[model samples]
Target: MGTYRFDPIGEAPEQIRFRVRIGPGYGSIRIGVDGIPQEWGWIAEEVADYRGEKVTRWRRSQALQDLEAELKTVAQAYNADHGSNVMTDCFMQAFFVFVESEDPGRLAWRAEFERRRRDRRA
Candidate 1:
């Protein structure tokens, strides 16, 4: 099961909140605020040629860094409690190599999907 962790920031009453998903293949975490799932997308690269030399058109570096930093602050307490970097992608947020974990309930759908996949492949 993927773990979910978060903390309030700025004492601002949490007008908005974000999520981090931790699961196999990075496709397990899914939750929503105000009944809407936060925008989630995977960065893809267009290989013009050459192996590992692809460029992504949707690279929004500064914005992503800002969001990542915010999420990290909120999830610090959670990370300490759980002993996991399930939210901030300790190595780096760009490249999408490391994925943060979400709350357990956040991954309910992912858990179900994994179970189904395993049962089918078994």
Candidate 2:
């Protein structure tokens, strides 16, 4: 899977960081409209570094929806033809992390979009 990092919009600085990731071939494949095959599944975690200790938390569906919507836009930019399908595959095999940090420049999901695009062409 590929890992990505970006600061959430209209949020407090250094308060929280968002991380999106696509699979390294995780989950099962399913057929969609017109018998188009795509993967399906998702994992999300909330990790907090508190007092030099790491704690894990569960995320609500809203977080996943936000991430999915953002990634769909990315997929559309990658390949207009099968953007939604490719994005679905990506999301199905994704692992998201909502971290508490301030570092940036870790976006890496484009490679996956390109790979899925190539697969669609094949």
Candidate 3:
């Protein structure tokens, strides 16, 4: 599992408060807010380049069922607990990366996304 802290892109620093822990290949996203935990299933699509064409196919993991529930419910719960809606907006701006671990391309993509996110906040 990989753990990361998600910072709100266009909100005040104090309003940023969410943690995302993803399983290998993003089997799930464990969202936490103010130390409360909620689990959500994650889905991934396989993209391939074949004959100079880009193709994407949705794939399902055998360990879990397809995600039929909304993941934002976790954010809603967090907002209710804090008596504030900041988390809702934060969740709206979240970027969920589904690349293989330690992949250079994915790292670069995430870095650039973060750069843009910071600029938006600025």
lDDT of each: 0.42, 0.36, 0.39
In terms of TM-score, the best-performing candidate is 1
Candidate 3 — which residues are off by over 4 angstroms? Answer: 1-100
TM-score of each: 0.28, 0.22, 0.23
Q: Which residue pairs show backbone clashes in model 1?
A: 3-102, 4-102, 4-103, 86-100, 86-101
Off by over 4 Å in 1: 1-17, 20-47, 51-57, 81-122
- In candidate 1, what are the lDDT values of residues 1-122, reduced to their tens digit? 97865432332234445454565765333322222122332233355545666543333234334444565544453432323365765442321223243433445667899999999999
Clashing pairs in 2: 41-92
TM-score of 1: 0.28
**How do the residues 56-93 of candidate 2 rate in per-residue lDDT, one tens digit apiece?**
44332444344345545444454323233564564432
**Candidate 1 lDDT for residue 113:** 91
What lDDT does candidate 3 reach at residue 85?
62
For candidate 2, the per-residue lDDT at 14 reads 34
Error of 1 at 84 (Å): 12
Q: In candidate 3, what are the lDDT values of residues 11-117, reduced to their tens digit?
A: 22243254567746643445533211112222345576766565544332321121212234433344323233675664332324322222234445788999999
